[model samples]
Target chain A: MSETPTLESLQAALDAQQAIFEMHQSMNMEVFYWWCTAIMFLIHAGFLAYEMGASRSKNALAAGIKNILALVVIIPTFYLFGWWIYNAFPGGFIPAEASAALPWSQSMGPDAKDLGTGVFWAAFALFGATTGSILSGAVIERIRVSAFLILTIVLGSGVWILGGAWGWHPDGWLLTKLGYHDVGASGVVHAIAGFFTLGVLLNLGARKGKFIDGVAQTISPHSLPMTLIGLMLIIVGFFGFLGGCIIFNGGDTGWTTIYGNPTNLSAFAFNTLMGFSGGIIGCYVATRDPFWTMSGGLVGIISVAAGLDLYDPGLAFIIATCMGVAAVYFAKLLENLGIDDAVGAVAVHGFTGVVAVILVGVFAAGTPNVNGLPPISFMGQLTSAGVMIALGFLPGYGLSLLLKKLNMLRVPEKCEELGIDEVEILAKPYPEAGVPAIAASDVPNKLANTELQGA
Target chain B: MGTSITTWENVSAYFTFADNPMALGLFVAGATVIVVGLIRSIIKHENEAFKQHK
Candidate 1:
């Protein structure tokens, strides 16, 4: 009994197909972000090696421990508050309506209805942790592990995520009001972290011999090879990070940036490679130093990161080269001002991010954000840059200042001279390097190692 | 709507968040991080402080 095809029947069948298509799209996005999270962990591993290699043999283990601890500590804190901040404060506070983002929300878990939130939340948590990694390198050797851990919590779970809520989120005021277009989080993550580290350094003081009688001296890395390898791993992680910055879907729909502007991984890959090379060239030309040269790759990517979804590969290279050169000179400028940023994080991440944010306006001006509410402009990015700097600097300065006054910020003076690994960790990084472990008996008020062992 | 956590019938049998035991479990983990970090700072600082009179 063949019945004439009715409009209702055709519509019903079409609706079923659309439902299947949408489900696949959601599943694909979830899977993509899951991998993105795994790849992003490489950034932390790279940071561990990079900072450890940068440290003198005495403090290498301490640097490794602090970096690892920051990674470990940030996870639970991010779960409790960082995710909530990202979802709730995107509308500039009051939470108006974000119960679904609450840690306690039924929707926050693996609900059959929503496949995206868990994976998306995991990716965002990794992004938040990267900000802590950026701060970790700069404060190595000199910072108290607990103090570093707390500051990592504050920055990773609190300050930087708030900036992300304002700039990175879709409904963020910066996006709605100013058309802020940081598709790669140049401002929210890198600049904020760099500025925050700067504020902390001003309070933490120079590592004892970093400055001598008003002159800055170079403290050589223990192993340049490890640092160079670690830098490449961070670049690889950033590729995954950039992949997460855009949305993917099934069917013929074009990949789009977080702001819904059409882009693809091809655009990201091209610009990342171009920018990475450009930074290396510029840094080698400027400093002729391997560490800065490797770091120039980071500077390059950050310099162009603001507009990765938009720039021509050639333009990205040129801009990255300029910023790479600028980062080295900027690091020197800060050094002159008595700020001792160990890995030039202040210049590499902070300075490059701010300039890249502003430069995107210069290059991509008049480009409309999603729905064309407002066009990108230099003023908009410049304004957002100011806010990011303040968000990073204020909490960093005030909280670290409190830590300093509490005598909990820097390592005890004697501890700094003896390597931190030997002083507190009790394990020598190099068994044959002849650095003796400091016994607790050396301190007048401290319990002796033998006494504790006897007990 | 599903509230029985021990039931194996469906995944939704567990309700998590806020006041739920699992949610509180997460909260306790976060609290431990904060407390342990503070304790470590204080102990390390006191253990190695230069003697006030010396």
Candidate 2:
């Protein structure tokens, strides 16, 4: 009467459905990582454009080239050794299976068996590049490109990665021993970069004409619109950066943090948006300047980043608002101290990063360490923060001082007077704008000028 | 096998090694590299001074 399915047929149907489900889950995680890696590229684009705009028209190209070269150098270097450093240094001494990340490793190339490592490495490389970019803007119009590349390699590939291995990695000594937790690298990437740049700034000195007779001068950007647009691009890129922070677990569990702590994109989205808006409001209240206003959005996010996984959304907003205001003022304080931070990288990244690290202790104390070494504590984060600052600042300061002694740190004063673009690049970003259309000898005098105006 | 939710405690428990000599060696090696890089940069600069901008 009916063509009923036999036990064998039913079993086969069930197996087929299970296989399809498994395949879909794996594919989704792969695509997710790829998407995050793609988004992180925006941070670099934003840095390039923003620094170019902040620089004088004469130095725009120099600023831009630095960014491009840093990206190029850091990428290859990261592949060769930086990846190994991350995998190996969790114990703060030796890398575990560090050879596995070497260029000769089979997994280093396309392998059907391993789908996640490449994309994960891509995302981390972007993070490394970002640390270099943060330093790029602060030192623009003055730093030697060669020195920048060397420092970028050191910081991006060596120092920052070491910090990550010690703290950010799942098996890091900080997490295992001190119960340290930083889900968003507020301390690992931002603070280290920010403070390291501070060290460089101390050695590199101020931009020429930035301070005169013990008073600070505002060296304005050539194009305000360009800077604004660049910042917006950075925000777009940040979506990718934060996405990379997550570890995608296949099947129903969905996502977790790099430390294997349970979390969701929904929580991240809520906190990120709230913090952004709160920062904007805080910045707008203090300084109506569009630059700081937009920057508040970034500060807000950093302020909330340390506790992004666990904070109430409203708390995220409040913390972001306070930090947004605080960041602007902190930049002012550094300016008062005669530091020439071209784009407030230190305040935005360093100060906010430190605050975020400490705030986690205050706000998120007793939160279970995702790796379960010890509970989150104020002392633990404080210790971790101090160690990170020392780790970052010492090498940066030491190396920059050595470069300074060698006279290879900053462009000569003459170059600053003429601009790096004119001296180094021998090209113009806006040749037409910089040079006049008519020849000096062909000038028609006032009568011709009147006629031209009439026409 | 299904994925496992790894808490901080669970992760810490999993990596049960009491000591890591490699990590200590890395710290020393890293310090050495930074110092060497700085000195090397100085030497390189002395041998071939970069052209001043322009």
Candidate 3:
């Protein structure tokens, strides 16, 4: 203090302060990621409500409970091993030398030292839950709760996580080798979920009375209001789900571009609203049905989700619109094939997700990689999308077939006819209606004299 | 012990005292409503069961 501080020393001190400031900024971003991940958990609630509403009254409670329970199983299992798989499998089948992010790993828990792991793990878990929800809708009324619960565990915790590890991770082999770029998991999440549902459907077969002599019958939802409410919630939750991925980058020189430039919330807001509007209009025009119209909203967002970060609002809207229309027709096509997807999960999630992956290539053709490599190309995007569909569908179908052979995939025909609620649950949701009341006089007469009862 | 309580306080403070408190509050309110809905559902179930028994 006595000597006037040298310019070099002052500069050094300023540099140190700047580094500390950057550290704090990074920590703030980590906090934001955690909050966003938590918000994404609402999507599960939305799915639960949506699927329950979509299911017949006989299977409503079962559908709701199954979707919720998938999370309970997925979270712990994923925590234990799922995180490791994501880091390990990015090279397709090969295991990488990356540090295994196991549940018991020191980095997993609340660590002031490393802030990224917790939020990232949570984000992946939300994706897993979404995958499970997609399967829950397809096999609602006919499937046993126990069997479906097991399926949820396998798909939510195991199969989907592995796929994410292989393809979704930036360092994943699919991305590194094939130049794959599914920015928001169109293929990794939705396509995989859809195919998995298809696999289960092949084994589970159609719900009783859904097919009569090789012809499909329509079973409409009991409550449209509930379904609409559920869809709205899903839309709201998706903002958090998709936005979380973008906001979580560790070093922000203040809202950097996907490739580290500079961005803002305004861009996301513009794209999301436009995409949603386009999807709604597209579905309405294509299907002329209110149900498909609502479903179009999901398709629209998912279709554009893979490239939303780079896309202009117009592009986002157009992609979303096209995706919505495609999802409706694809769903109809599946139904025509005598595949009874109770909630059209396969068509909406799988088909739209695959399309979105391809669209990303076209739309984000020249967008620079965050790692400063070449921009993602159309051919590269298609190849990656194809790989995901093949990987997801083949194993999923094979596993379902194996489960069917073991008599574990679907309930018996007798059980399906009696209703899964009556046979498996041992507790009817609507006990009064399910158990018809016998008059006291009639009951006594039946016991005393069979002939009197007949008369 | 002091540190733990302080950490909790810090977390809580981040939530309520953030910019765009209305949006944050609405999100929290939505969560609370879902929770309350679940509780109401359980209570209704119990009431229905009791009625059936009666």
Best-to-worst order by TM-score is 1, 2, 3
TM-score of chain B of each: 0.43, 0.50, 0.55
DockQ-derived CAPRI band for the predicted complex in model 2: incorrect
Task: Tell me how far the alpha carbon of residue A41 in candidate 2 is from the true structure, in angstroms, after superposition.
Answer: 1.1
Kindly list the per-residue Cα lDDT of model 3 for residues A1-455, writing each as its tens digit.
49788999899999999889878877888787777777777787788888878877766776777777677767766766677887777766777865637443445555555556777788788878788888888888766555666677678777777777766665666666656666567788888888888877877888878889877798887666778788888888888777664644544355643334345667667777887888888899998877778887888888877776678999899888887888888988987888999888888888988888898888777665666544678988888787767766776678777767866666566655555444444344445553456622211122455666646
DockQ of 1: 0.24
Candidate 3 chain A: 10-residue stretch with minimal lDDT: A439-448
Give the candidate number with the greatest DockQ. 1
Write out the backbone clash pairs for model 3: A90-A172, A90-A173, A91-A173, A257-A261
Which stretches of model 3 miss by more than 4 angstroms? A1-16, A250-264, A370-374, A426-455, B1-54
lDDT of each candidate versus the true structure: 0.85, 0.82, 0.72
DockQ for each numbered candidate:
0.24, 0.05, 0.03
Candidate 2 regions exceeding 4 Å error are: A1-17, A436-455, B1-54
Model 3 CA lDDT for position A423: 43
The most accurate candidate by lDDT is: 1
lDDT of 1 by residue, A248-291 (tens): 85568769888777888988888889989999999999999999
Clashes of each: 2, 14, 4
List residue ranges in candidate 1 displaced over 4 A. A1-18, A249-253, A434-455, B1-54
